[model samples]
Target: MSQTRSADRNETGPDRGVLPQRLAGLGAALMVLMPLAMWLANRSAPLTLGLAAALLLAAAAAAGSSREVAARLRRLLATPPGLALAAFLGWALLSILWSHDKAASLRAWGELALPIVFALALAASGRFRPRPTWLRALAFAILLACLLVMVELASGLSQRAALGLGKLMSFVFNRPAITALVLAAPTIHGLWSLPEGRRFDRILAIALALAVAACALRSESASARLGVAVCALCWGLAALWPRLTLTAAGCAFVVAMAMAPVLGIAARDGLPSLILNRFAVMTGQARIDIWLSFGEVARARPLAGAGFGTSATMHRNPVVAEVAPEHRLLLGAGHPHDMPLQAWAETGAVGAGLLVLAGLLLLARLRRLPAREMAPRLALFAAAFAISVVGHGAWQGWWIAVLGAGILWFGPGAARPQGEDHG
Candidate 1:
């Protein structure tokens, strides 16, 4: 009945043509299938292929949209999030002039362009909004994937080695960073299901949430654990005081910032050494060492970065060698694992600030939504943010694809309430 009503809602309009609608559906379907993509092919292969299909389909839909194509483009670019995205993308492209390796920088631009185009296509697919069922679907998909991860992990300790049989992998079964990136989707979706689902559905959602959280904790990602902790705190605050939602968020952010230093010190001092030691072998510290190295390199060319994708070349510099020669030699030259540092290193302070501004605009957009709608989006954002804070190359293809998927899945259209079916 709910499904029928949703169909009716779309059909009542001037048909929008079957092709465009199907294309939109196809794009959404691909996004929902991302985890499974990771499981089948390489971690990013499915995502890249799926999203590529999605992008092509969405563009076709947009071109076929009854609304004028130019008008849609203007509308998308006019929004705050859109403008911020444009600023960052434009800045990144312009940096090619100053980029140490123009070819690599141009390649980086191509990778960056994928998400930007995907986002625009999604924006243009106006009626293709995220719904409660879509949320349920995404959550269920992630839940199943987490179960698979657990199964892989259960094979045995030797198999559980980082490169072993059942080691902690990202959604793509790649290397581990933080558990939050993969689990955030399901966890947040599960949380959103609690209030609106039937008894069995609620039970299933709760079980999935608990299971995913446990899996994250058991994994080798400190970031995942930290991100989950933040999500839980936010979930608790919202659950306990539904009326003061924004207040709860403000409190959470302020507290998180204040506690970060303290937590860092504690972690370094062996507060959770037994647990921390498990991840030490994963080059968790080595990644941090790389980030520190990036910081030194970023300092030299603070205004315009060494160039997009230039970190590999700059890592051999004396500045980084002087700071942590042993760790530097051990880790080799790689992109900075942290986004802010990556932006600063490649695009400079201006790029970093624009990236942050875009994020803030996205959050502000979420803030405008009704609480029921906002909750999961906020949770997903928190999870993604926490995971990215300490891991992944800023422009890594898979990372960009995953982040882009999240952005479109929970973005503006997704956040809008669609009457009682959604509420």
Candidate 2:
């Protein structure tokens, strides 16, 4: 049940017209080459964003009839997930009025909004087609990327030097490693679910999973390791009881938003000085101080927040200056480096509550799906959720784009003709 049952019964299918064929080819290329693209990103969000844009446009071209697009969008927006996401986005827009940097808030809101339109359309559109070979190519791509990343890490990043990508640190491969972790879930599930006699595909899936686990354990990125652990756990849990896992994850989001500030304050006060210092060193930031500062800010303005998109410039705002000197280490820190904490800080109770509802609705929409579909998606949610809470900014464009790219396979084309693989 952990496997996603590929519609292998009919590997053969009716012919696709020329335009559809072209779209399938492009989609296949994007799916197969995604891992390499992430590696090439070298931790640059802009490069990742470009890759995500290409995917959205390709999907649009595939399912882009005006009538079809309108129908799909209308249907999606009618669902709880779509409606909740819309409400959250609206709340974000409203926060702009109170934002210290209104222009920046508007820009950030776009980064969050644009990707959803493309993704939701694809998910709701029946015209989009997926290929079996694309899934095969995906596993191979992840395998190839893992081998290459290992080579880079082992050789002191010699390949990076030859590419003229600059003298970036080894942490550059961190994102690629994390990408493989997220991609591995569906890739392995699809491969392992091959028909009864297909031993080769199952073997490949097992090998890919091990390679992904190896990369996560080998990397210096703690977040990547956390993602891998959560992926495995959720993959198993969702297979057995998907509804329970989804409900728990949704409830966790709400509880986390409510208690984030309190936990930060408690940790700062109760944790031993030595333990706090170790945490600071391990995270490579003054994490405790940042947490306390942002925690205090959230506590001070628990309702509407200091306003969206202000986390980056919060140090300059008068509200942050009024906090105690010890909590003032947020200067030029860029972001609080924690997603839920940032949401709690910038959007306050209103934004956080909307986000919690959106998260639950999005996940609940997956209910009653066949076990094959539910497992992979829930596993992916686990990895993404882990990445969100463990690290990264709340509104980073590339992060939003990567999330969009990951869901390309989720829409209504499951029984699509497999002939696209041959076309």
Candidate 3:
């Protein structure tokens, strides 16, 4: 009877191992599918929620019933950095509820929730430890999507600008620039992880770079371009001055902001009529006016914001009269084109503080880990996230949640350990 019981245990245990593998596979497939869903839905809430649910289930399943899963989750929650981030997010949500435009605030807050939840879920599952094959699969998906977009854009050229796809192709076919930024980080990390001097590796790197460049160039969206540029600059700074990178980045940001108006105007009215036409009266070009108006609204109701999705009210405010007539049609503006400002305007200072704290906590958590273990990937993710914001404004909740989950699941670095080297 003892032997029979032991035999039974062996069979069942093997089956259990299969479950984790199956779960991991599902998680990976969902990772690819989520972006596709976003493309199809054009970043709508229903699609985002569906993807988020799928990711959570996949992560949970991958974790199985292992004692290690529970232990790791406890450790993660107990970590001061993680808790601080959660607290900040909670504050932000509370602030959102206090907004005058409660419905709008709720809508805006809903967008932020997705990424946070996704990240937490991934971290909790402990199944995101890097796997080369998984990384390769992700890279392939991104490349395929990019290629399809390129083909579509090229095909439309002969049909003239009338049939030209441009942003539509990006939004519907490939990941939007914001999503691209997130996806790009992992692709770069995967590239770096590959054995050096391989022809295929070089080819892959070039292909990814080209795809990224193409997406940026064709986007016609200013913030998206800015996001990619920022990401590149971050990579350079991180390589040169890991310690002073943040300070330098801050300085650079100030300088950029100071110069934006001058350069922006030139871009808006430049001789290259096509480019200028794209920039003129664009959503990004009007961000300054919108941001300024948003500040005033927030000031008027400091404790609670205008409420989520209340940017429309601010847009229709008398302030709209001050903007260029061409830009006056922005009454339906959904956000202030800045994350912190949007938070404050929708939720209040308390909510904004929480969002800020959460971001800082994420950065801090990344800092505590060995650079060699996580820096490359973190750098990529940071670059992508930053770039996306420049072009697309702040990400919605679902994107953030899924991205966070991906990082947590995969953050510890590749399963194969390597010696620490700061450089």
Candidate 4:
């Protein structure tokens, strides 16, 4: 009777810990809803919603109903990488706080804070299980967000003339590359998590692919499109290439594709000309010029950087000066389009080094995990994160931190034999 009851619980129960499970669902749901809500609220809702959700999760976590859940959280906190990542971010935040530009530093700090806290919360919740149902819920939320954006665009309800929803348009309006990076991680996760046998899963995956394509077409953001392609390629290679050589080759192909613009190669005939003509006026070679300028500045200030958010202060070109009168406002003109460049420009070599080191450590840790167990999901996550870094700028720190937290949460402690949970 006890064995039968255990089987039933494994198949269907409250996921062993109610608070943690609910919080996971809530986190996923919020990720989808917040974008649409931000659009409707004209970008103000996200801050409010984020703060409220954080508070609510904190409250729930403090209730202390489940000793098992609490114990798991304690164990996660004791992990070396988890503790180190948190400490490094905390130190970075402190440095920002002590900087001269308190407001800009505060804003940057806030961006990092949200993801870090969410990651910790998710990790602490002790419901680190990556079940099919949870993945479907997350995917459905993203699809719904995409649909809402399409509706807003089609109905002429958006304030901007862009093809995406009004809320995301705000971010995409300023930094489409970053937005693409943020969206890519979750989309890849959803795609990889989908069950192969389910017709609905296949349909959903196809729909998501089409949605990403349409968003890219409508926005005319090359970086966004590249991000999606890179993510897809990464997932494909990781899922199919159980061997190291094939995976390496696949990775090389993805790297080449991502760097095509820098290599002076066009994705399609006439594409380069079209992009140059469309975005040249706004971004000046669609950020190639800005990236070069940032490199020079970083070379000048190799230690502490020009200081966080100091790119505009160092942008001496007459055209950029006229376009961006203030330093912080320079992001509006076209800040560094590359993540490493942005980090180097703002925080200097030290900051950039720390960031790179963190990434390397993450990759190494993920690689050490049991391939048969977490290889597929870990590969998907790594690929998505890598694409974001290579394709965009500093806008992905939050998502990167979140992905790290999720991996840590569901990693060693949550590992179960492949078919153990199968009923």
lDDT values for all models: 0.59, 0.69, 0.52, 0.48
Best by TM-score: 2
User: Can you give the lDDT of residue 283 in candidate 1?
Assistant: 45
Model 1 worst lDDT run, 10 consecutive residues: 257-266
Count of clashing pairs, candidate 2: 0
Winner on TM-score (2 vs 3): 2
Please tell me which model should have the higher lDDT, number 1 or number 4.
1
Who is ahead in lDDT, 2 or 3? 2
Winner on lDDT between 2 and 4 is 2
For each candidate in turn, the TM-score is 0.75, 0.85, 0.72, 0.66
Give the top-scoring candidate (lDDT): 2
Taking every candidate in turn, the Cα RMSD to the unseen true structure, in Å, is 5.5, 5.2, 7.4, 7.1
Give the Cα error of residue 368 in candidate 1, in Å. 2.9
Residue 155 CA displacement from its true place in model 1, Å: 1.8
Model with the higher TM-score, candidate 1 or 4: 1
- lDDT of candidate 4 vs native? 0.48
**Residue pairs in collision within model 2:** none
Over 36-69, each residue of candidate 2 has an lDDT whose tens digit, in order, gives 8878774443343354345534544554444555
- Model 3 bad stretches (over 4 Å): 1-17, 35-37, 44-67, 101-104, 157-175, 195-199, 250-278, 283-285, 312-332, 368-378, 381-385, 388-395, 405-410, 413-423
Model 1 lDDT per residue over 132-197, tens place: 666667667767666666666566433345445432444334322232244345435544455555
The candidate, 3 or 4, that scores higher on TM-score is 3
